[model samples]
Target: MSEPNEALRRLLRESGWTLSQCARAVNRVGAEDGTPLRYDASGVHHWLGGTIPRGQVPRFIVEAFSRRLSRTVTCAEAGFEPQSGQPSQQTDIVDELIELGRYDMDPSRRGVLGATLFSVTLTVPDWPNVAGRLVAVESGRAHRIGVREVDAVRAMTEELSRLDDQFGGRHARPMAAAFLVNTVGSHLRADASEPVRKSLFSATADLLYLTGFMAVDEGLHGAAQQYYLKALEYAGAAEDHLTYCTTLRGMSLQAVDLGHAKRAERLADAAAAAAPAAGPRMRAFLAGQQAHSYAATGSKHQALTYIREAEVAMEKAEARAKAFGSYAPSSLAYHVSQVKYALGDKVGAIESLKESDRLRHSHYRRSSVRYNSLLAERQFELGHLEEACSTWERVLDDYPLVSSGSADRKIQHMKSLLRPHLRNPTAAHVYQRAQDQAESA
Candidate 1:
């Protein structure tokens, strides 16, 4: 009925385990992971008979296989789709966020962290229309929230924002997630009045959005996707249109990074539409995102058009610092690199990246490493192997300090690029050093 579950059948054949045994293993694994699933021989037979299990069963099945094989086994390979469908209520989104953080904390379930693709759902969440009441504050227990409390959250965000620049999300993601779980989680549901609740929502939205960025840096795109969506839902609830638009831009950036360029362009455009009267900083940021997506999609004309528009907006911009980071000259240079690379102007891309390097922010070490890796690759592309190799050395010096999946990718890519040049002593040394780094980590 459902294509005979051939993928699952194949995996089963390779594992050399009976369906019943697999069922027991899966159920056991689920219990260990805190997801109590009740599966047995019949359930396994049904799945093999083309009845795909729903809920978290798919994840459990994959995890079971991962344990048995001593390697990661993704849900897709087990013929399972992601858990989908819009969460019905605002509280549901909050609840989901909390669970996500907990799951992230579990080292056993961390294999699911670097999910390969993003789930696409662009339904403008209808959360705001459903309810107008805030959760009741606990009597004598709910922390009294005022402007001061909100400002404190903002201050914390600003500091972490700088750290995220200097060290990278690998360095900051756990703290952000812990902050969400330990501090922000209770505030979302714990009592407050109209104005206070609104401010709380807005403040939490910024932190959640940053958490999403942290997820991105860790190469957990699916986690980032949920974090962004939940932040957007919070923004809508807060009536913070600017944050809503900014969150949308963050979502667009994630999609582009994941290579869903068409959807990325759509998301970027949606951000602009959400805040048609946004200030120049956001306007330039959105335009730059749009241009990158266009370039990715090979729409050079539209890409260049948006590029000019972004530069014009940047020129008119005032430096307003927020949790999103101040829009410095480096930001524009970063966009220029993307645009030029997309247009097949390798040399121009390299130049833009180098300039951006000078203006780069403190805590964005992951992006710094990533873009520099790009710059090195570009240099290699232009037959400047010595320069490229030198750049690799510089990035390698910092790579071990950050715990970013994105940075992991850049390092791995750098290693691959060195493979062809093993004849060169410098490249050989870097390659051996990468091996040592991998072994030590």
Candidate 2:
């Protein structure tokens, strides 16, 4: 027989919820995750008495407590073992990636995955831990792959990235997930010459990174981190420093966006440390993120120093025709705006954001909506009601064309911010338009 779940009992007591209330909270979380459960007081009683809840019930319980306590609660902390068949730290990266991608591809499973809590305490493998660690698959069904397969994967990744930029991840992520499951998974298992194998891994790593970026765009932070970890694993296996560092930087961006400044700073610093030999553009990219994160953490001197470094590297980078990833002048400007805002220079941040919008590429429709909405919010914060309304109108112009969770969140914020100012004609008009867009959406 299982031992009594003393830890869970303690947490339950701390929550001050009766057994029935606890069961109802779990049921509510399950319902939100699209897995309706009729759990009752008996279920909580059994769990408290050492009975293990089956399937995803433990996760639901953990989430319920987390919501009540307003903090993360791990399975171990809740006196539950890790779920059977769930990916663990010891799971094979390739197999785990395939499973994650397949789940992402299935519409029915997507809701549950989307409801996953973004753990601030997620363990990320360092460069030394994962570097060159991938072992060859010894399956009898493993086939041979070549340069052709590698090129095809890279081309497909590029096309999906373009689609993500033009529309949003909501429209492109499913296709990417399908490709990862049906095509890239097989390629990873296939045998290849040493050089071809490394190239294939590198290409696959890039695809994983893009898919993770799309997951972030969809507000699937937990899923995005899983995809990014796989990308780092693949990049490390391939000895691809660029993708490894880039994936870390992407995670930092996600953390900062979610208001985890210290975690973001640590990740940004790790990205910079991992890519010791990065070029000028890559340096600019990494330093720009570091600046924003540091500023967010209230490190004024460090933030200014890193931003200066980014500017110098960007100046040198512009002399070359080739770009490193998508870290253009526009992206740099956005980082500058973030840093300025973090340091309390709201006006400077606005001006920098305007510069970013001006320099932004035409294909970045999703970014336009997200950033313009941010600009409008800042404008409203500064009492520029009419100007804020004007900017929000611009956002609505492109809002219908984009399908991004981040953009949707910004529009929601616009409505809340305009509520008190509804007496103003422009604010009332913008709020109505946003309402119409939300209903239509």
Candidate 3:
């Protein structure tokens, strides 16, 4: 009645894993996702013999192979049919965004969404392909909207961003997702004047970008990419070059954080190319990211050139009275640190990171935890055990206040790095304190 899964068998052969091992890996992924399964060798055998695994098992299987092979493994590649209810390429952007938001807001679905694998081979639509391509969503009961609605969306986005900065995405993202599903979706489907409609699209794009950024802070990389793609669609539909380029740049940040250097370089360059008329501050923001991506790709000369451009742009830009989440001197410093580290200048990286921390704003508590932990790791690398311990203590101080996946990872890494040095009194004390914090968390 069914054809054998030759594609999956091929991937299984490439993975060099026994049937039991494959099943165990899927089960492990399920457990991590809080959807524990009892898959076994027989399950794998049946899957390979043409029996389709039901209810998210296929996703788990693909993720397991992706992990083993260190690359993405899609369902089609594994000979599985597309799951029902999953969005297809032909789905409208507004509908896709609403679906993503709804899933993100639901507690039962959130775990599965969180476990979605970040695909390195994801196809990114170019500016030319997406620009001004708004699909009209006709509704029979469309309500009239105006400038007030646009302003309200903008104000809410700003407030959510502030909360994310003060606490972390883990605390703010749910509220943002709920807002997107309950309020923004209806607004998108409402009738409006041409100018007001475009303005609404631009404002909503900004909110989507911020929501994606918060998803990244929580380590939901794949879900973040989905949010970013929707943001790009909306920004392009609005013909808003600034937000379009900004969303691309945000996607680049996500790729770079996940260690996809070449992809990051491509995205950063695309962002720069898309916004030729960007202001000094935006240029600095874009160029700073370009510098890090270039350095990560081993293009030292290009990296230095971009970093210099960013520095010049920063100097030319006027100071903003309220630059909450805007790119500033500290962000540039962090980029410089990343470039220096990538180029084998560890001491230079440390100095730049210290400068970044000093220049950082007080509201960015999550950033403080992440960057300070990075500083401590560099210090440990340079054999400054006591100094590293002291830096880690600072991280612990802020760790309790921020609920960020990135910060959690940094603390976990700190513990791992201090293991060999635990014989030292300072290292042991810091390790114990970190252990206690982690347990409480």
Candidate 4:
């Protein structure tokens, strides 16, 4: 171990608390936030001996000290910036997101991924401010974006969405990133009429959402998060409340995928609060996401409540003519399936997904197969091992044709699920097939 951390030791001494007490406080704080720190006196002893905590631990420690001292304290003041660099402060996040966008557009650069800490603490600061923050619009530029250009961007986004649905983000991301760099980025700075500017901002937000989604496909989660934040910023600048909340849903989706259910629920709840008057489809979508977040974090009551709310909202949406928009209407069944599975309603989840599979767009074969594989896993969990193995037959059929990181993960996990049942004939056959498919992939 290195020498004692003078900064942290000084803070401990000034606070007049034993190291064990500080550790317990940090653990309590972590538990309230859905992160079980399990810190004890020994952990504090290590921290004083220059051990830098990882993930959200440093943030929790700072919080613990801050609460005890009745003053703000940052990680750096407590000597916790070595493993990862200090996160960009909340006030500087906008500029940081912009900088992140530039890094993303640079093809030669690779943003953070794999073992890099995702500070849930750093993603959204001052949630209310972000919800209403109005970014400054520049007055003049060499190029003026008009209605025609804005319309063109919207049309392009729709076509890109179709392609992303049919193929995958792997096929469409380069173009989306290039569009942001070549067109949307410049348009944001160009002078235009108020209506045109707002439309352009809205279109840019749409483009950024696509860019962020594609980043997830590429497994650049950190960069994807930054893009979503910038998208929300532009959406707010456009005064488009629906788009802003929509971006929040995207962020929440990523959070759930990353296993940060607590943060996911926070973003989802914030979206629900901000979009009280969104159209039925949008409202249904937000409600479904809340159900997903709640389920992931084991909040069964909250999850089930939002699940019914989502179903009701979607029924209301379908009663009217589908509104023209950039988003696909809420797939209530698909979203609900996730919640059902999380809540241990496995049969319910499978039934919901099967229903969703029927109504799903033909263009999204990758997602369909992925959902089927999930259904199979639930079957396996419930002791129908042979049936579960057979269920994957369709997945393997489509697996070769599709290119998706998410799909790949599903297939990989499903393959693991088969290994335990390999003594059975059907399981043996399916395991061999999975092995062969892996080689081909």
Q: How do the predictions measure up, each by TM-score?
A: 0.77, 0.85, 0.86, 0.77
RMSD in order of candidates: 8.6, 5.0, 4.2, 5.6
lDDT of 4 by residue, 247-292 (tens): 7888888889777798799999988888878777777888899999
Give the C-alpha lDDT of model 1.
Answer: 0.75
Worst 10 residues of 2 by lDDT: 318-327
TM-score for candidate 2, residues paired by index: 0.85
Clashes of 1: 8
Give the 10-residue window scoring lowest on summed lDDT in candidate 1: 130-139
What digit string (tens of lDDT, one per residue) describes model 1 on residues 117-164?
345443445334422333343334456566776777777777777677
- Tell me the tens digit of each residue's lDDT in model 3 across 165-213: 8788887898889999899889888888888888988888899999999
Residue 409 Cα positional deviation in candidate 2, in Å, after optimal superposition: 1.0
Tens-place lDDT digits, model 2, residues 70-104: 67787899999865444344356677778888778
Candidate with top TM-score is 3
Candidate 3: Cα lDDT at 43: 94
Residue 408 error, candidate 3, Å = 1.3
- The lDDT values for all models are 0.75, 0.86, 0.86, 0.74
| lDDT measured at residue 40 in model 3 versus the true structure, 0 to 100 | 88
Q: Please list the residue runs of candidate 1 whose C-alpha ends up more than 4 Å from where it truly belongs after superposition.
A: 1-93, 108-117, 121-143, 323-325, 439-441
